[model samples]
Target: MIWKEILIRYGELSTKGRNKKDFINRLRANIRHLFSDIAPLEIVSERDRMHIKIENDEQYEVLMKKLPTVFGIQSFSPVAVCSKELDDMKKLSLIIMEQFKEQEITFKVEVRRSDKTFPLESHEIQREIGGHVLRNNPNISVQVKKPDVELRIEVRQDAIYMMAQIIQGAGGMPVGSNGKSLLMLSGGIDSPVAGYLLMKRGVRLEAIHFFSPPYTSDNSLEKVKVLANELTKFGANIRLHVIPFTEIQVLIKDRVPSNTIMTTTRRMMMRIADKLREEIGALGIVTGESLGQVASQTLESLTAINDVSNTPILRPLIAFDKLEIIDIAEQIGTYETSIQPFEDCCTIFTPANPKTKPKVEKVTYYESFTEFDELIERAVRNREVYKFPEVNQVKDKFEGLL
Candidate 1:
């Protein structure tokens, strides 16, 4: 009689088997957190399915728009709850058939009875529902194999659920489901894109940005925040840690040969980033480095930089070309913000003829001269932290709209 339920589907969680309960529990908690603002809705979990219910209809549309942006869900549908009796099911079927009259719709009834005592089998219920709907509305055809609208009916112990529409889900494992990584987020075209891809694959990311104030303007720092905000649309509300790198950068420029400056600076960044990663419990470090993209991204430079970090270094865009990465950047809505003219740490003190390939020994020798340990410790100590709001906060702001 009423559309009061939301059905959730999991693409990869199906494989979790015995440990599925933990994953489902985590997902349910996250969903509860996500919709914390919409008070009338309740989230429920079962052995095979997840259901979200609403005491009022007002919150449904808002949930429809927002839940698709969440990371853990594969797909969801807004469903009606009604009596399992044939007459009630037929009435609802006619309403659904009438609603989609404009399109050349091929719909079918998909039924499942958790309480097997229901007299009819799933297929028999499907056929019976199909006949009832056909009798009421003659225009819509029935396609058992491939239907534009699948009217799903579930006969539970206490209630019967039926729904006609399925909304596409974000379709990935949950962020933090995979573990944590420290992304080296520069306000650049590639790094945010790289960060987005890693986050898409269930990696919870915290960002590390090197800032050289007076060298890199405050506007540039703001740009990174803006970029992180945009990434929040994809469920990565990253904690950005800004490191002071002006002195270390200046020392690198002065002590290292001009051609080797980029390479030397990158290696130092790897060391500093690794230290911070350990301090913060990050399992690995992520970078925007793409193969052969620039001088410092050359194989030799990448190898030298990799040598410094004891933790795993994840370069999501390592194999992607500029065009390929840009396509993804545009798809994720970061391309526009990334193109803004804001300098990042790498642009500070850029050498005209930076080395395409520098030896590790040379980079090591340069580091040995200065108090490298002291500089890294100082930079980490002077770090700035930023956090984003939880789902409840989002609701607090948008409750009136709901």
Candidate 2:
């Protein structure tokens, strides 16, 4: 029988041993949810490997596209499965080698004999399959190290699978394995990468973006939503909160010193973010801040801003350099969307010569210049909420994002 399946490989989850079943089940659920629209016939997982069977050939490309974004998967491959016996595997190996038979190139046959009760050892099976493939096509030569084609045979208890290629996956802990956090997702390179890093560590996220509608266009808010959508591909759903921030920016500028506005603005943002954390039942608030990267990101500046924080603050990119953060942004598929010219609330209300060494007491004294508590409450109360789901946007809710 000609059977089509995709083989999935995982990384650190293999080390879980007795607890591995829980991790495997979580990863399996993540894969199923992310590819809910693709609709595979069944996802059969055993030991450290998973095999996804499809009913039609058309689902191949769709499944391939979704697999790369599913965390906990180290790699995957499309395969043709056959019976567990030796002759059946050799016959299948010969057919699998036909794709490379057209070109005169170096190749290797690798065998993973999991069931040792069979007649041949791993190297013996490789030699036998290699000889059989070469006899059918003289154009193929042998190479041990690296080759144009590496035909693989996996001997499992139930069946033997054959494939010639492997595709890389996102490679991280399953999202939701860890608790959730509130991501301060700005329309910039660092925040998205920060969210990506936290997601890699298994932290699920709900993002909050501040938008000044008249000062910043709806197009800019849409850009932020696009970045949020890019993140959901990494095995987590993002419920985005868009806050009306023009009033806050104007108040900070009107009542605060020009040099201290950046620090004061961030303090208010932290306050609002902390409130969001409590309201949404998040463990902490995460940001893209790097040390001395900007006026507000300085150690002293961060301390002053975080003074008003009621919840813990997590800055994953705190020590990362610009290029390092950019590298992760590109790797996680959010760099292009982040680089879009649409500006965000953070870019508004220019503060020339902003305070890099802001003190909490001084920031407190500055806030005393105006009554700001009512406005922070107003911003949070007027916020719009959106949930980006894994499938069926209408039923699962991707409000305002569609």
Candidate 3:
């Protein structure tokens, strides 16, 4: 029988032991919801691994493209059919090997006979396949530890699966499994990476972008929108809030001390982010602030910023260096876009020697001169909100493709 299935590998979830079944069930439900439009795919649980099977091949391919974005799966393989017994498994392995027999390479048979009742054990089957392949094609070498190609045969209760490759998955717990946060997204290298990491941990994200258009150009705003679009590939459609930060920034520069301008602005930003988070049902706020990554990220400065946030502020990148953050940014396809020479509102103002540590009382003194609270309220109330849908925009929701 030729049927398509998705094999899922969990990471830290397996450590849950007795609680593993609960996680698996939740993961299955999440997967089903994400692929709701494609087909009715049932998730089959087997010990620590989970397999997804659909009625048709087209649905399998569609799910393959979508499931990699899912958080729980470490890697997946698309396999062909076989039987549980030794001879049928070897026949299928030989046929698959013949397709790649001539290449100058090494190969090994990896067997996971879940059913011990099968006549031969996993190691015995691996050796038998190695012997058969060597007998048919003398030039191929037998390398056990690691090989250029691994022909895997998994023996299950109902069927045997064979495949030559494994596809990498998004790798993390399922989204919503960790709860939700509002990410402070800037049109720069760091914040998107921060959001990506949060999502990897199964944290659902909504974004708040501070824009100083005219000072920060239309291209800068568009750059942020593009960045959000790129991130949607990982899952969960994002609702991005664009706020007019230019006015507030100018007020801070003029009213506050030059040394404290950056700190004061960050404090105001935290206050505004907290309000936005409360309105949107987010449990906390996320930032890309890494320790010693920048002047404003200093402990004293962060403390001043934190004072305004009654809600928890999560800095996922707090301990990571610039190089480490950049390395991951490159891996997740955001580095190229992030490194673009477009300035966002955060960098446009004149604060060459901003304060590394700021006092809350001093910032309060500066705010006394202007009605800053009113300005923040207006900015949040009149913010331009855009929602990027989770499903790909092949067509409009009702109209369909033309």
Candidate 4:
């Protein structure tokens, strides 16, 4: 490949004034972590844009495939480095344009002369290079407004770079720049989609999954693990905390009134999640509770759940329709796995006639009969923690006897 560097443009990060450097540093760190398994790289972060110098075609190919998945990048270009000489610029421009040789292409030349001391002005360089390409290639025509192909040239202090394509990036602030949160991940379609949206907004995540054995099978737990692993593709590795919730779930089912059981159960989950959030130093709790999608997601039910904790409850898909949530789940590659036939704790014990407008006072009175504080503490203590995108310890166990 002729391109020697990948130019990255920061999208929302550019709007940050004094904190710009912090965001940029965080982005650079994320890029480094994302590409750690690949060859060593020289990632240069600048005031306006960042560049990853391409060492070979292999590195370029890998970068092109993976870079778009990273947040904070608005767009990127594969740039061909050239000398300051006009002849060198012209020759390289023709070489770059050869990709569109046979087709009739509307093209324009854009030049950014960062090195003001360069002899030619920005327009001068554009004209010189543009004139060269038109003279040589008969199929290429110049169009100023939204050209089909734009040959962008940047005359920087060290070297001049040129490219024809600007690929769109996953635009947002860098992950972890906003802060950290604990995602109340469930073995369902909506929770994974909720996690994706939060990560897109630069919130780092550690997931909490409730598990109830016998009531919920191992397959159900595996499904949640798969979802958490799938989510790691968007940003950094996620630590999935699996809480042993069988005792608490059973107590709620036996003690609470049948109609208001869902509300009480959800409140218990909130209390446990909030406790874990505090333990892990998370700022808030994230859930996939879309408004009115289920009995537990109604305004009254959400308010009842909210009363368990003072910490913020972030419901990213609160207003989204079911179809809208599914579309995002499909886009992020979690739909197929999430649709697997597995019964999670929430679904396994779903009430026959759950109260849509459950009274908080009534649910509170019913839950007061059960001693839940000790069970909640024990569940959090016996939780299983696994880091995603890494080999799970349970999966690595030797089953056959030696």
Q: Each model's RMSD to truth, in Å?
A: 4.2, 3.7, 4.3, 3.2
Record all residue pairs in model 1 with backbone atoms less than 3 Å apart, i.e. clashing: none
The clash tally of candidate 4 reads 0
Regions of candidate 2 where Cα sits further than 4 Å from its true position: 1-3, 84-88, 101-106, 114-117, 137-140, 145-149, 389-402
Question: Which 10-residue span in candidate 2 carries the lowest summed lDDT?
Answer: 390-399
Estimate every model's Cα lDDT from 0 to 1. 0.80, 0.84, 0.80, 0.90
Q: Supply the TM-score for candidate 2.
A: 0.89
Tell me how far the alpha carbon of residue 301 in candidate 3 is from the true structure, in angstroms, after superposition. 1.4
Regions more than 4 Å wrong, model 3:
1-3, 17-19, 33-37, 54-67, 84-88, 98-107, 114-124, 146-149, 390-402
**lDDT per residue (tens digit) for residues 245-357 in model 3:** 88999888888888888888888888889888989999989999998778899898888889877898888899998999999889877787777777887886757788887
TM-score of 4: 0.94
Listed in order, each prediction's TM-score against the native is 0.90, 0.89, 0.87, 0.94
Q: Which has the higher lDDT value, candidate number 2 or candidate number 4?
A: 4
Q: Can you rank all candidates by TM-score, best first?
A: 4, 1, 2, 3
Name the 10 consecutive residues with the lowest summed lDDT in model 4: 393-402
